[model samples]
Target: MKRREAREKAVQTLFQLDRTEMSIDEAITYIIESPIDPFYERLVKGTVNHKEEIDKTLEDKLEHWSLERLPKIERTVLRLAVYELLFEDEIPHSVVLNEAVELCKRFGDEKSGRFVNGVLSKFEQK
Candidate 1:
């Protein structure tokens, strides 16, 4: 799968992990195909591995909203995007930001895209 599909898969996988009791492997397997894209694997696993740091960073960026107060899918998207911004140096920051907004749009409420965009823009400015 391409990066876009991989990103979508990563978002769903991460969301499943956050909202359910599924293990990382189970979450990935449930969300992705047998030959999982390498990028997708890295996104899910890396995000999980670095979740504490990611959440902390997001907490600092959030204006009025606490990380846990965010909707599940939006919180998942933010975590995944923060992973890319902090770890996946190979991917452009703009791509990470854009893909995150897209994910929120696809899986979250109408305001999700704007919320994600606003949070991600803080990373870009720094």
Candidate 2:
């Protein structure tokens, strides 16, 4: 699968894992029907594996809202993007940020994209 597709699925899978008790494997299977794509799995697994660090990074970036207070979609998108930004050096920062905004626009509310960009731009600037 393409990186874009994998990112969208990773956001969805991460969203599922966030909202439920589902394991990573269960979340992956629920979202992706075909053989597991490495990129998608990496996004989900890497995010889960380093969630505490990701959340801490997010916690520091959030203005007034706490990480838990953010919408689930936004929270998951941030986690996935942060995972890429922090660990996946193969992808450019701009691509990760742009894809994150697109994911928010596609799966989240009208303001989700703007919110994601605002938070992630801080990381980009650092």
Candidate 3:
């Protein structure tokens, strides 16, 4: 499983959390058992554990955009990328940014990729 595929699953997992309010364990089980690749499992675990901080960071960085205003998919993708950039030092910031752009292109609206890129660029500047 490539990182982008894992990121896709992570985005879906985050989106589902809004509706299901499932426990992390349950979420992990669901993601692992589902078609989502094992490589993304770590991302799912990391995102769930630190969602509040991640969300807060996103909100902080996106000065003009409220977290609630963004689409769920876009928000989830951004959250995953932001988490990697802030917490996953092993992965370069550029990798996180590029993968995030790819995810936006695939899963988001027409402007999503650019929006994600701009937000993450702001994150990197800090």
Q: Select the stronger candidate by TM-score from 1 and 2.
A: 2
Which candidate ranks first by TM-score, i.e. highest? 2
Per-residue alpha-carbon lDDT of model 1 for 13-123, expressed as tens digits? 998899578899999888876887889999999999999999999999999999889989889999999999999888888888889888987888769999998999999
Give the TM-scores of the predictions, in the order they appear. Answer: 0.94, 0.95, 0.85
Score each candidate by Cα lDDT.
0.89, 0.90, 0.80
Candidate 2 TM-score versus the reference: 0.95
What would the per-residue lDDT of candidate 2 be over residues 1-126, giving only the tens digit for each residue? Answer: 999999988988898899688998988898999788998888899999999999999899999999879989999999999999999988888898899999998998769999999999998632
Error of 1 at 83 (Å): 0.3
lDDT of 3 by residue, 1-126 (tens): 777767877777777776576976677667657664656777887887788999898988886789989888788888888888877888888888889888888888669988888889986532
Model 2 lDDT on a 0 to 1 scale: 0.90
Worst 10 residues of 1 by lDDT: 117-126
Candidate no. 3 TM-score:
0.85
Query: What's the residue-level lDDT of 20 in candidate 1?
Result: 75
Clash pairs, candidate 2, are none
